[model samples]
Target: MAKAFASQGDMADKKISFTEVGRDLWAFTAEGDPNTGVIIGDDSVMIVDAQATPRLANMVVEKVRSVTDKPIKHVVLTHYHAVRVLGASAYAASEIIMSDKARAMVVERGQEDWDSEFERFPRLFQGHESIPGLTWPTQTFAGRMTVYLGTRRVDLMHLGRAHTAGDIVAHVPDANVMFTGDIVEYHSACYCGDGHFGDWGGTLNAIKAFDVDAIAPGRGDALVGKALVGEAIENTRDFVDSTYRPAKRIAARGGSLKETWDAVRADCDPKFASYAIYEHCLPFNVARAYDEARGIDTPRIWTAERDKAMWNALQA
Candidate 1:
């Protein structure tokens, strides 16, 4: 029989972990599911990356309440993926911020992404009915912005494009801990369906320049030491490179997408087969890598119909 589509077979609940990566900074991780970063300041809290729905976001709220009573005042979205921003309503944050390019992506392809991802991974969108609508940022910045919660300073910057065109990172200077969204994943697969393969390395290098003490990565365990932080970054870079290199070589010879898929699998499977979401991400990553190698600058938008068509084609 054909394999289950996308994450349709992944129904088991992930064990949740709320870890302190810095003095007052926490990482809300659910196994290899999407992770959220919490930065508590003197007066309020800042949430980096809202969960997929109100119910999931509320879980983060419960964790927050365990520590302090500070109201969640800001929701900083690293990118415009549905899993990252659709849960903004639950926070009721006064300000929801994203990079200018990200906000434009919301206007351009947000609905399609919501539809596509909802179909791709139903587990993440539990309590989907509670989602108000596409989450829009209350404010948008061009390159960087500094947000203050009383005395604490959180710097948000759009270093470059990696996972998506509008990726950003939140750096808490007080603790020297950075919250890197899908731009950096510890052991989990990097979803590169909408990624920029050519510029991803430079973006990773830009992040390396920070030399942060710790990091709450997009997925997987919270990185709490310089050693682990470096490992995750370099591993992420290797994952991206390993996936793209073989696909690029295949595409250069005018190979079919299916052929490129097989090539990428041969190159990546031994190293990353056990990574979270590795199977779900393979087809899309190969598709995007194939496109990038063919000189496609911007990633093609993925709609639900296109998602099925691509998956079926690869499986065939």
Candidate 2:
């Protein structure tokens, strides 16, 4: 059992732990590790967000088997991040699904993201060889889709952009649970370089309208109670506002990216300083916030070299 978030310190042996959230819903979590949600219907199961590699994803398979033998008939991608989408084949899912926009993101920047993320976090991609190729959805939906396991309904909705343009959430109305891709992370510094800050707050509100009894955030522990659900969304909103304010202040004053980072760190570090992957996320978050503040409507492509250049310019 690896202590959670040891990846934050480059500890190589950290393992993940998955928690059961409801009767047939399990929230797969690790210490600050990316999360995967398991939704069991009457006869089949669906996995939300595949892990970084097949080897890592198999660990979730083991955890799922501990509870049920039902085959995972579907794999629902919350977004297109390599860590979340690459190891999708490990599941028994015959039908892999994602939003229409998610499919386009893969078309647009999948390869670049794959390289960039590998450089940013090597520990997550332990079994890199197992990834066959860029994951493609067997089925894609535009606005919303309803999946059924007998009578159980899984409502997959694109509730506006937040973590990424293609970000979506799965709401089990009966269970009143939602799996928010990277849109809702608990006690973790959100990796928001690919995010839309202005719209994220609206997206959170959209999720809350579902009146979820519990939440399996993209990272961190499952929200056990309704009150905790509110807290998680609030914290996520705060992180965006905090990052944006400083970045905007710097942009407005015509300051350089380095100065923007410095301004943002004074507030973010003191508060989210100890969050999971806090250091790893700072440079990227600052870049997105800075660009958005300067009227950059679209997110800039983030290559590995660009990631390093930004980190050096801001952190060093």
| Leading candidate by lDDT | 1
- For each of the candidates, the C-alpha root-mean-square deviation to the true structure, in angstroms, is 0.8, 3.2
What TM-score do all the candidates reach, one by one?
Answer: 0.99, 0.96
CA-lDDT, candidates in order: 0.94, 0.88
Lowest summed-lDDT stretch of 10 residues in model 2? 1-10
* lDDT (Cα, tens digit) per residue for candidate 1, span 1-316: 8978899899999999999999999999998999999999999999999988989999999999999998889999999999999989997745999999999999999999999999988999989999989998999999999999999999999999999999999999989999999999988999999999899999999989999999999999999999999999999999999999998899889889889988889989999999999988988999999999999988999999999998898853
Residue 188 lDDT in candidate 2: 87
lDDT of 2 by residue, 69-112 (tens): 98788899999999999989886446899999999999999999
Cα deviation at 60, candidate 2, in Å, is 0.4
User: What lDDT is obtained when candidate 1 is compared to the true structure?
Assistant: 0.94
Candidate 2 structure lDDT: 0.88
